[model samples]
Target: SQQGEEDPQALSIQEGENATMNCSYKTSINNLQWYRQNSGRGLVHLILIRSNEREKHSGRLRVTLDTSKKSSSLLITASRAADTASYFCATYNTDKLIFGTGTRLQVFP
Candidate 1:
């Protein structure tokens, strides 16, 4: 199974600001997804964008996929204190889910 790697291992911002995370993969994938994890807790799926899709959004989350570049990006709009978490990007390779290293986002109020 291949793995996606997120850039800038960590991020910090204040409440009301936005956070952006980028991911790069080594191979083609079926779908790309984003997840958020708080500290040591489990991850919560944020959004999923298929390879054929250019962009998708849910609430404050905006995801964009670029097949040519084998990359994707996640953006959180108007972030809040509760948005603080570790963000990850994942892709489906064959029968497995390959996850990125993750970006730790700290939202300070």
Candidate 2:
């Protein structure tokens, strides 16, 4: 519906498995950020990757961006039940952050 839209509206995975979610945008972006939000809570900043960078990693999270395709993806390795939350990809457009529809991740124990 917007510039940034994520695929697989919902994702269910087993604990210790890796979960991947993708986002596609229509326009250019300065940087992309990944965030996680538990049920009924605020978003938590996970990681950020610049347009010039291909990939970035932090703890169990990995993020990749392809400016040419105007797309990005977020990967969570060794997921846990605690990782069950909503993941959103946000892109910097001018001075605003345009966020994707988000993917609901459920890590089964």
Candidate 3:
């Protein structure tokens, strides 16, 4: 599949902890993007890593892409209770995006 799928589809962590998510795709991609969705809410874009970039960081989020391996990973450092949300990895393909199933994250206070 051209879609990027996240591993360990579900996660639960305590506040101030770190959460890591990984994605694997079947084909090459121009770029990879991470998104967050609150319960019953639309998704919010988090970060994007181009094929040429080995790693990128924004705020508490870090993303790494390994084009050779057809995989990527996302790490959210020092997660907070507010970070409770569903996270998705998407790949850009031919002017459109194909989103994977997603990872459900639950953060407890």
State TM-scores per candidate: 0.96, 0.95, 0.95
Better of 2 and 3 by lDDT: 3
Give candidate 1's TM-score: 0.96
Model 3 C-alpha RMSD to native: 1.2
Candidate 1 residues 8-79, lDDT tens each?
Answer: 799999999989999999888889999889998999988999989999989888999999999999999999
Residue-level error in angstroms, candidate 3, position 37: 0.6
lDDT of each prediction vs. the true structure?
0.90, 0.90, 0.91
lDDT order, best first, reads 3, 1, 2
lDDT leader = 3
Model 1 ranges off by over 4 Å: none
Looking at model 2, the pairs that clash are none
Runs off by more than 4 Å, candidate 3: none
Count clashes in each candidate, considering only residues at least 3 apart in sequence or on different chains. Answer: 0, 0, 0
